[model samples]
Target: MISPVIQEEATGCGIASVANIVGKTYPEMKAIANGLGIYADDTALWSDTQYVRTLLKNEGIATSDNEIPFTTWDNLPDTALLAIKHHQEDGKDFWHWVVFKRIDGNAMVIDSAAYLDSNTRTDFGEMTPKWFIKVSLLHESSFDA
Candidate 1:
């Protein structure tokens, strides 16, 4: 699980407001996350291990050149939290925040986002690649071990 402090830093009150709160640059934060074994990539809209490694490299984390399994939404690890963009039918983009709290039951939760209007919340089961960017964060202990 991500530390409360780090989680607060990563997922600020709102996406727009986050820009100001996430003191570190996007690349910098990404690097820090990568150092902690989080996979932050901008690949083919999917979570491939190689793609993740590439993303880590892009964020300045050194890694051995190797191929690895890609992580799918359905296969994400329990210790991971994914920040994805959820596309709406009307063509507008909605930011979706999801924490992989449990993998055994194939369940996840969409916490909240800045783009949501007042009194609205999105769920993990209600996400799609069209509207969301797939970013993952790994637990500190998991990264250390």
Candidate 2:
């Protein structure tokens, strides 16, 4: 039930995360991202939060305005975009993007890296998240319907 969209490119984790959150395929999100001039190859896509936020905004999804520092996995919102595998290169910070979801009171992570044998993950003990952006599935305008 948690089929993650695999990143089609080496630097496409951000795009893939957006796809997973929005229920779109990698190519589908990639096309929209390209149309918005948000390319995966841009280093800012991973090192900065704006790109992912922008993509989500364009799709009518709402995310927290600020990055919340990681505390405990149990404290994460029902859905979130988590930053893991963090490191600095040339004094710039970078991280891998993954989606956290709570379904039927069960939590699992969706990782887009193509190297993973299974993308739906539950080994939370193995990951060290640096921060996260809480994803809201509904836009304020949704209530207008």
Best by TM-score: 2
Per-residue lDDT of candidate 1, residues 38-57 (tens digit): 43232221333343344434
- Number of clashing pairs per prediction, in order: 7, 0
Locate the minimum summed-lDDT window of 10 residues in model 2: 136-145
Q: Point out where model 1 deviates above 4 Å.
A: 1-71, 86-97, 103-106, 114-125, 129-145
Worst 10 residues of 1 by lDDT: 13-22
Residue 33's lDDT in candidate 1: 47
Cα error, residue 36 of model 1, in Å, equals 15
Task: Give per-residue CA lDDT, model 2, range 1-145, as digits (tens).
Answer: 7778999999999999999998999999999999999999999999999999999989879888889999999999888999999999999999999999999999999999999999999999999999999888554433110
Q: Model-by-model lDDT, in order?
A: 0.36, 0.92
